[model samples]
Structures are given as C-alpha cells and as structure tokens.
Target: MARPAVRRGAALGLGMLWWWAVLRLAFAPGAGVLEAAVAAGGWGLSVLPVHCVPRAQAAGAVGPERWRGAWRAVRTTTASPLRRSDAGSGPW
Candidate 1:
C-alpha cells in the first residue's frame, strides 16, 4: 500500500540523514577516536526513546507502564555486556 511505501521512504530518509550526520561528526576537525565513539554512543542513546516509545505503545502499554517498559528495554540492552558471565571476559 501507499502508506507502507511512504513509511519506508521516510525511514530511509531518516537513516540517510543520520548516516550523514555521523560521518560529518566523525570527520570533523580535531575529532579523534574517543570523540567519534562518544558522539555515536550519544546518538544511539538519544534515539532509544524514539524506538522504545513506539514499541511500548504497540504493545498496549500506557503512561507509566510505557515508560517503564522503555526503561527496562534500555537497561537490559545497555547492561547485556556487563551481565555476561563468561570467564576471562573483560570490558572489551
């Protein structure tokens, strides 16, 4: 349907914009590895709420429940590496 096509187009457009922004920041003057990594991480964190809110709403969550679900999702995702129990597995 046209609606689906439009949604896909919008998603692609946003993705391209995000890619361009990341590239610009990564290559900016005086930007090093740490700066690039921090920028990328911050961008990812900022987008998390956008993704989480929609998913929570789709699941029929409301108000505080929606936010709680989002927070839980974020916490689990970010804590996954730290929660790993494998031996000799450092923060790397």
Candidate 2:
C-alpha cells in the first residue's frame, strides 16, 4: 500500500487532471477546434477528459467545488383544501 503522503499526492494530481479537463471542455469554442486539439495532443492529455467527465453529455457536468457539499434540507408542509373540485382538465 502506498504511504499516506504518496496517496494524497496521487489524489491531488488526479484531481488536478480532472479539473483541467473540465475547464478545457467548458472553455472550448467549438467541437471541431476542441476535437482537433485533443486529437493532436499527447496520449495522456486525450485520455484525461474521457476518464474525467462523461462523453455522453452535450453540456458536461461542471460544478463549483463548493457544490460538492453545500446541501440544505428544507421542511415544508401544506394542507389540501377540504373541498376540492377539478375543472375537468388542467396541467398535470
């Protein structure tokens, strides 16, 4: 097993590689230009984005670091009317 320091360093390196891809795809002006650049880039460079973000997404999953754990739970309760009538049809 790698030492704690080694593992952390590896994780940091990999995370940097991930964010690099996210940034690249986000700023990319057009498909042709990005594709050409990736095709001409180093083997490792080409593989980074594929491993990082999903290829299936047209607009890739890019999120702020804070979004990682900025969750807030909300509690709301509403009482339905005792007497209710539908207008035959309405938006579901």
Candidate 3:
C-alpha cells in the first residue's frame, strides 16, 4: 500500500544521505586517521567471507567459533604479559 511505499522511500533517502556523509568525510582534510579507521573498521560489516567458508555437517562452518577461541587465547596471553618491577619505583 501507500504506507509501504512511503517507508521504502524514506529508507532509500536515508541510505543516500548516510552514504553522502561518509563519502564527504572520507574526502575531507584533517579527517585522515579517524576517517581511515572508520572505513577499515566498517569492512567487518560485510559477511561474505564468513558465508564463503565451507560447511561440514550442515550450513555454516565452525571456523567462526574457532576464530573466537583463538582471539580469546591471544588476548589472555597479551593482556598482562609484561610486569612492572617495583623494586625502587617512585610513587606513580
């Protein structure tokens, strides 16, 4: 109905506006590190890579879980790896 059409139009307009804002910032000066980081981080928005993983028993691979576990292990090791010596340290 007309309601659905209105909703679709609003969504399209909002999407275009969002895209414009991102592109503008992407090309703006003094927006180097911050803009580049935002773009790079947005790369995870695409799930095509996850879908590309082959399935074993059913759909979807177990790789994502394994990947998560690996990340946790890495975090645990790196979180407090280096210790500060307090032999004769000043009040910090």
Candidate 4:
C-alpha cells in the first residue's frame, strides 16, 4: 500500500525533476537527444526505482549492492522464465 505510493511519488517527482533539468532548464546548453537521454538516465539510476527505468540502464542510486532487495528480485525475474516484457512489472 504505502510502498507503492512511495514508489509512485518517487517516480513522478524524479520524472518532473529530470524533465525540468533536461528540457526547461539549461541542463545541456546545446546538447542534443543523446546527451539529454544520458543525463536522464543518470538521474534515473541515481534516484528513481528500478522498475521505473528501461532495459538500457543499471540499477540503484550507486550500484546493485546499495540498491534495495526489490532490485535483486526484478533483476532475477528479468532473467528468468517468469520474466515480463514490461520493465514496470518489477516486484512490488
């Protein structure tokens, strides 16, 4: 219950933060799609939940060891037969 809310809040909050930085502000004065994407990726990896991200990036704010157990669950699932094509289907 509360956990899902928290994760959603984190996702929405960080998503706006990232969008503002990459689009509204001068996150990259003259940068193009690639740089904006990379910056967004970095922001996501550092704060957003593992499930909110896509297949391209790694897990956690720092790394796998630092990420919560949920990350491990998703990682293991993504590799198993129970794996879901949708990245958002990570363990809840």
How close to the true structure is residue 79 of candidate 2, measured as C-alpha lDDT? Answer: 69
Off by over 4 Å in 2: 30-92
- 5-50: candidate 3 lDDT, tens digit per residue: 9999986875565565568676766556555555555554543465
RMSD of 1: 13.4
Q: Between candidates 2 and 4, which one is better according to lDDT?
A: 4
- Residues 1-92, model 4: lDDT tens digits: 99999999998987776776576436447667765775678676878564666534746345545466656567433554655677666666
Off by over 4 Å in 4: 25-92
lDDT of each: 0.67, 0.57, 0.63, 0.66
- Give the C-alpha lDDT of model 3: 0.63
Instruction: State how far residue 86 of model 1 sits from its true place (Å).
Output: 45
Query: In model 4, how large is the Cα lDDT of residue 13?
Result: 88
Best by TM-score: 1
> What are the clashing pairs of model 1?
none
- lDDT digits (tens) for residues 1-92 of candidate 1: 89999999987876666666577676777646665665576578667755454644576656787778988876434444545566676677
- TM-score ranking, high to low: 1, 3, 4, 2
